[model samples]
Target chain A: MTTDRAHSLKQLRRMLLVRRFEEKCAEVYQQQKIRGFLHLYIGEEAVAVGALAALRDDDAVVTTYREHGHALVRGISPDAVMAEMYGRATGCARGRGGSMHLFGAAQRFFGGYAIVGGGLPIAVGLALAEQMQATKRLVACFFGDGATEEGEYHESLNLASLWRLPVLFLCENNFYAMGTALARHAAVPDLCAIPRAHGIVSESVDGMDVVAVERAARAAADAIRETGKPRFLELQTYRFRAHSMYDADRYRDKAEIAEWKKRDPIELFVARLKAASVATDEDVAAIEREVSGEVERAALAADAAPLEPISDLERDVLAKVVP
Target chain B: MTRTTYREGIRTALRTALHDDPRVFLMGEDVGKYGGAYACSLGLLEDFGPERVRDTPLCESTFVGAGIGAALGGMRPIVEIMTVNFSLLALDQIVNNAATLRHMSAGQFAVPLVVRMATGAGRQLAAQHSHSLENWYAHVPGIKVLASGTVQDAHDFVLEALADPDPVIVFEHQYLYAMEGELELGPARASPWRASVRRAGADLSVITYGGSLPKALAAAEALEAEGIRAEVVDLRSLRPLDDETILASVRKTHRALIVDEGWRTGSLSGELATRIMEGAFYDLDGPIARVCSAEVPIPYAKHLEDEALPRVETIVARAKELVARRG
Candidate 1:
């Protein structure tokens, strides 16, 4: 709602940060720094940043493995996230979770769960907790279009709807479940119908436009809070990078990637900001510079972080019981 | 001492947990209106109301995952997965989420969740309805596997397991639910982590748990007729096995025989045998032996089912052979 110059710039800076951070990760990944299933949120930045901006800090967030953008936008620092991927003692998860699993309980960001549709039920439970406590705090669960193919996804939707819990089922439909395209996997390629079939209030948004994403997400979140029911949003987006670092990318065409890259969320947002006279060319340049500097420092700090000793390997298998 | 059936003991535990903890809730198929598939939660719905006693649709994976989520969200959730056979549908949630959440999240999130399910083979419930797969859960690192065979354990382990800060799997043996026993009604006697010496002897250590505990005890009793004093050790908690008590029993008895209702191949009995070999091999008078179920799908026929599962006859025979060996 507060889409003034300052707030608009903040969102722009956040998107820029997510973009720059992943770009740096992609760079360092080639240098053999970050390892293991790096599913970059390179193009889907608008979905995480825009949707996260629509909710309160206390509202929970449960997202997928491809959640660097979501975690960064939801308030985890680049250093902590980077250090986690670096497997450092000072990391957000104490170096336990790598790129696929980022956790910050203090922020109420439940985690970046790796399993597809695995986080959906968790998000429903978080909302169930909030509902039982009468906290009015909603949970925004982000998953890909691939998750809708999972049974947990359908069950979660039904439970959330049946109980009328506050949850926003944000599906980043980037047209691919790793390598298989939507049509190849889903019998009904249209995702909105599935949630609508479950009697959930559903909407579709242009995920490339940050303004559109934020607007749709805000309305969805507001409705959930008021009705205490789940809402589904199908954000039509595309991933600018491979699914993971190891992906051969033989499934998608080169022309398709080029077309999607042309409508990159960060660049599109900057263009809209300039057109609306919300931010100047100089303001955009300053934001880019600031994000780049922060990313550089975070990468350096993470590289210097220490790996936990083998003695502490068994520390978290179970919580220590008090005698 | 309170004389109650194992079913009543479980019911009491559930009743007490729901009454005491405001955050605790039980959800599973037929748990509410139908009073649970096993009737362990016979009148919980009427007592606690709908919010606390939830009867879920048969979406095991989602409900189990929801339990893990609710636990992570700071609510104590107890999810019932009807039977171990049906639990396979939610294996992803149990193995991947509940068990892996704590360690993978670097302890930032502890899944203080309890999952209860009926387990083991008996009755006329054929192949699909009967099986003992606690070994699969015990194989995981972050979970505590509890097998409640007696009335006291049925009443106690559920209460104690809830106090644990990690995921605990409670397997209530289907056959043992009707067995009535005496419960020392007071505070829980001890931590559920250690094995309990049900009947002590100096000849053979007959190790077992869950439905097989009774069979092993009966076998020990029958073995006593022939002057073979066999000790019975009930492994209350299967995952964090009480190796010290097991070793101590084997050290004292100088012989060991494991009776388990599960299949012999890749069984909890095998793990126990390995642990005994590692800890008290020198003290053993002969090769460690185990009397486990026949490696076949459980049959509904009374005669076949009885022969397939570990029996007191098999246990006594295995013990006599082990004790007779001169090695």
Candidate 2:
């Protein structure tokens, strides 16, 4: 296969993996295995798979609680991610940070900040560090449309722009801040305008399409690299699952949900691959099997992983005193 | 040895830290150009240049949170929050991010950030600008909270706090900024974790910190004139309360009077009183008494403000009463 074909195939495989992993998480949550505020990125897989594909290895990523997809794509081992959900010793955060706090320092994945708009300032700071160090590295900060209403969002944008820090503000506009629609929470639902008001370059993209997200992210990342300034991209997408396991999801209409499902990212991407002759039917079937197998193995490994010792409960609260 | 004002001591400490460590930088609103709201970072901006001394926008949360991020990225950052009242704007970043990041990240990162903010009421800065809220910060777990009561502590604790690999909050009492004292500053004379007995006595223990330290000492002196010797214990570190020093003092005096500027309701004084009750109940000759600010919002009127806050007269009176009640 050609290089482009291989890359497209890889994207398809990643999206499938995220979808299948989240499906397994949902299943196990009911089985009493994975617990505590599981936010599945079922419909928003394309944004993570696409945007992360544009980042360099040394570049940093700070994301929100709905960050399993971001973590997986940022090269964190799926087994470690799964183990973290199980609260095991081998987890990314050593079982201390459950679903909403996954961290992989080696990969420069800062955290899965549960607080809305909390990660924005941290991203600006990370970018400031790189700028001060005269490094070309940039930081990608991911938050929801709901975060636009937060003061940190505005503050972060202003600081990033004023300092000319290299940062990509990826606003994943899933249209709901946990059942409160954007219109109800924000004066202006067009999040792209919010960053523009802060004097940062801003744009909105079809977040459901992986190729579009990748293109927009690469352009934004490149612009930040060239100018050492911040850029904002509003990824317009939807969430297929309930906000968390506990949500009754009574806030939205079923008709709206069904309409969004018609443009399901994974299904649309598979059709695009086939139409473009990037992958045949047999190839697609093979990719599905591989992704399913990987998810199964990860689940099994997480289940077998050891629990952190109770005696070490106080570990990592403070940095260990170097003797 | 040089005599320095509390403000000068803080400025000297910042200068020393900047000169000592290449990784250290100062960022805050008006820190660089305006020379700091409390003038603690004056002249250093011109000395170090703009890159090391950054002047940020008037957005507290983002700037404070940025300090945390910069620390995580391997730079020692000293973020000034103007005053405790303004620090509230950044409380989310301080309490949620800086304090919790190390633990939440499971040791993947340590925020070596020092946040300096002027605290307490005395200049009649009104309800918005004045209030003692160090207790709120001390209530946190991950971050270390230090109250600089003297010129020596103001000069030294900044260095010690910067050396630590955790987030540390240094509360500079706004009232004590102009107070001058001789400091033999080279290395810090004491750890920021332990409490120091400012004055030693056997009759009563006057426990206090920050802006109340002088009042506590004055009360001790007044008691000395009255033939009642009172020990003055300055609680330099608020978070890890030096239970040893406190218990030792209580054991010696058999009477304790906590003088705190923070209000009586859910104050650090209350916590200290509880600690004394729990550990040295048998050692106590009388019930533990406390002179804290009134529960009402700190009024702007000087007399009302004086009444609201713990005064030297109140401290002396409370001490005398406690001593008399010691049976």
Candidate 3:
């Protein structure tokens, strides 16, 4: 709906932010500044950035553990997300939610759920609430390719379609469900077709291409917001990093990894911008420098932030700043 | 005070909650068209239609997880697990997802979700369906546990739980459904977090909740004939144990006995005894006691099932022992 320049620039900023933030996270994890399973969204930035760009600020989002990218794209400050990864009190969840559970209520980012296929039903529920209240807000749910194997995913799709709730199921088909390749796990290699079984409108697009992802996501998000019906989008992508910090480089062949790495979403987007004369090489480098600066500043702030005291451990267990 | 069965009281609460809030809805196996496995949602499907009154696939873990998700997503979701026995299939979602979401999110999210299920023994239901596992749910943090023992509680607890900003589990006794009584569906208010004094006495404090509540009340009525006054404390909320209520009663009676329908070993009774030892040990004049289910699987036969669960006679005997030993 918006102009092509605005969309391209927003996508550039988001993709760069995710890449830089996660690269910093990887470095921090090595330095022990961050702990827990840090699943980086290094090569899969287009799915979160492109899809989230299609959503409004009031619209909610639910995602899986690989969610640093989702949080950044959904408008959570880099400082808060970085501090959360550092387990600092200034973090988004006041440092209680680490890498796997980043939550930003202000932005309507429901959570970064760690449980596989866990965010699906939640998105459906949120959509149900919106539909019941007659609100125009839509719920965007992001999960991995592996989540389709989970019963919650199927159940959520059926419930959403059955109720005609306004929700978008965005499956980040990164070709793996935590080291289990989609080919090995899924009977049908195509994940989008699965939603059709639930009577949901489904589409698959190349996740490495930002414009394609944004176009498809915008169309799907608009349909859900206007019609109060669920839509599914499968973004075929791949992860350049391991499943977690403990994962060794043993899941797939190096060439396959290299093959997918060549289609790097961020790099291709930057190249496309150069070819189309939308932005110069200097402009792309300047954007990279800007993201690196933001990541460094966030890391510094997080390093300076205080660790949550043990006394307040029992606090915030039952109640939150109620909406 | 309008008269209603325990089943009808719960239904009224559901009807009221659904009518009051647009966010509140029900989901579980047979909760919609089939009218629920236990008939708790008998007419909700007709009144609310399939949108508000939803029937889920037999995927307990996913549906329960979805309820947690739905709550996190700003909806008040009430999930029914046919019975407490079947809830085990979704225990991981309950314990790991629902119970830990708020704390794990560092207060970013508070799951206003309620999970309802039938519990305790009595019906000729076999071992799988007859076990009372409130103690297991109570053991977890980040979740509030409730047991509805009266018609008022059956109606009041669901509304209160729905109002809470945290996850709550309501254990509805299967046998209590048929029991009839007046149900005044009152406005939602915080029923004090502490235990309630069902019947006051001076000899021994009898702490019980849910299925054992009626048996304790009956035991109290019978114990009155024996000249031993037993103070019956109904523990409505189990997790955030109204320790003050139990401790004050223990101080008044100087002796205590916990009546629980759960098994003897590692039960809620065990936790109550430990709490008494820690909080009211100095105030106690005698040893703490408990009359829990026998340490065995609940048999299918009606007679054996009655023997395995805590009955009025058994609670009376346990209370008499505590009173007699009040040296």
| Best of the candidates, lDDT | 2
Higher-ranked by DockQ: 2 or 3 = 2
Tens-place lDDT digits, model 3, residues A89-188: 9999987789989888899988888878767777877787787678999999999888998877887888888879888999999888887888999999
lDDT of 2 by residue, A1-323 (tens): 22389899999889988899989999989998998999999999999999999999999999999999999989888899999999999899989888999999999999989889899999998888888888999999999988888999889999999999999999999999999998899887778787898899898999999999999999999999999989999999999989999999999999999999999998998888788777899998999999899999999999999999999988887763321
Listed models, DockQ each: 0.67, 0.63, 0.44
Across residues A130-241, which tens digit of lDDT does each residue of candidate 1 receive?
8777898999999999999999999999998888889999999999999999999999988899999989999999999898999999999999988888999999999998
List pairs with backbone clashes in candidate 2.
none
Worst 10 residues of 3 chain B by lDDT: B185-194
Fnat per candidate, as a fraction, reads 0.65, 0.65, 0.62
Best by DockQ: 1
Q: What lDDT tens digits, residue by residue, belong to model 1 across residues B1-327?
A: 989899999899889899889999998899999999889999999999999999888899988888888888888998999999999989888888888777877888888889999998888799999999999999998888999878999989888888889899999999999999997766747778889999989899999999999999899899999999999999999988989999999999889899888888998989999999999989988999989889899999999999899988889999999989977
Candidates, ranked, TM-score: 1, 2, 3
lDDT scores for all predictions? 0.90, 0.91, 0.87
TM-scores for chain A, candidates in order? 0.98, 0.98, 0.97
Across B1-327, the per-residue lDDT of candidate 2 in tens digits comes to: 898899999999999999998889999999998999999999998999999999999899999999988887778999998999999999999888888888777899899999999999988888988899999999998888899899999988888889988899999999999999988877637887889999999998899999999999988898899999999999999977889999999999999999999988898988999999999999999898999988888889999888888899999899889998947
